[model samples]
Target: MYLLIASDLDGTLLLPGDTFGAFTKSVIHSLNRAGHHIVLATGRHQTDVESLLDSQSLPVHLITSNGARISSACGGLALSEELPASVVRTLIEETREDTDLTINLYCQSGWLMNREDRNLRDFSQNPGFQPTICATENLPLSTVQKVFFFQRNKDHQALTRLQARLEQRLGSQISTVFTFAWCLEVMTRDVSKGNALRQLADFLNVPIQACIAFGDGMNDADMLAGVGKGVLMGNAHTELFQALPDAEVIGPCTDEAVAHYLSKHLLQSTALPA
Candidate 1:
């Protein structure tokens, strides 16, 4: 039976430095060729995710910005949710000068920043998402899909503090999580990778019981838990592993573990509905 195979990009599909190995390319290509659906669900912006798949052209769906935006197989956003304008304005005003954090805005206009962050431009693809450093007052608040904060050092303490601060102020207005310890993401309370996956399944006429998802981050928690089979990488963030302790644990992403498991399923035609 055909199934939906959704995966988060960073820590689940790619190897070190945001690169995919040849094995990954081959397995996904084979999977798509076999008629199982593949969706790139990620916390990344559309341009960044697009650049990563520009060469492969295998994805049938795209979920970006931690599910704040979803695109169809034709590669245009079909569903989107924007954060409250007043909240965006307040967030910028509160943290624009906070040197301890690198704030980013994923807007309909494009990926943006309150300040320059050369390090975060680490994607290994052209036409990639470039950080457009704009003045805090000039940020396009009305069209923003997701807002995030990060540090090059992957500083957990600072990000933890920032999460607490944002939650204290916004409370139910936003959903917050660490896709990784270094990056604290904020979206409308209604946005999530899980919800996007469900929406995509319904759009494609696939049932949730026929979906398998893989990931290794807290932002991925909902997606993993909501699927029929949720696979967690051995190298997943501690908090993520802790959150989904019952999830299937596979080898590390660096070892191309996702590819290996997928290949077995593809080759053996293992029935995954559980």
Candidate 2:
């Protein structure tokens, strides 16, 4: 039996619609009814995810802040990893002089940004969200989960140059993933949805072969590449699709394509009704 279904939110499982399509919901319910666990792994923090859960009604065990934190839906916190205090201090010091970029920091408590950062200011206006603002130069030297560099209209050359520079300075000690074309995320080398999934799979006693993962961003690439069955949204970046040959490529989730594929190939023969 299929044992686990782990998917990224934002652009993969949760599309533009305020709600999941009926077929997708049914497939998810069917999977749950069959006793498989569902996990929502994303760059979002706990509060952001909780708000979405309340609006969408799809309860998920969360692997948030790109695996910096993990918690069950029924209210028990399980695991979390934080950047070393030294590393967090170093990162904050390195980026302060660069005013062209805005920084977002994720920690065990929640997300932090400068009060004047327009992007963050607008995001905070949305109800049920809980991000705190603090001075970049005065940020707490506590552990951090990830650091985001948010910029506007960055080109490939600019992004490549930045990534190359970061690699030269930090090497493999830091892991970087781009959740959106305009944003770059830096986390500890050992943290990712893939690593988190490995831990979750072990906890559930589910082999990799019994799992399927779906996603649409560069951050989702590693997990998609490593899983037994990976599904890439048709609208995902072209380069990402080329990097994972074994992944099942399908239409955009908004088209109900993911649900159709799951229902037709995975649940048709063995599902118990929701």
- Give per-model CA RMSD: 2.3, 3.4
* True-structure Cα RMSD, model 2: 3.4
Task: Report the C-alpha lDDT of model 2 over 1-274, residue by residue, as the tens digit.
Answer: 5567888876677657334677777788887776778888888876678776775676568888888778875665488887778766666776677676677888766778754554554234335665677888767767688887766444455655666777677777788887767677888878898888888777777887677888888888877777777889888887687788657788886887777767776677664222
Candidate 2 clash pair list: none
Looking at candidate 2, what is the lDDT of residue 164? 72
**Which structure among the candidates has the greatest TM-score?**
1
Best by lDDT: 1
Candidate no. 1 TM-score? 0.90
Give the range of the ten consecutive residues with the poorest summed lDDT in model 1: 118-127
Give the TM-score of each candidate.
Answer: 0.90, 0.87
lDDT of 1 by residue, 194-228 (tens): 99999989988899978889898888899999888
Local distance difference test, candidate 2:
0.74
Steric clash count of candidate 2: 0
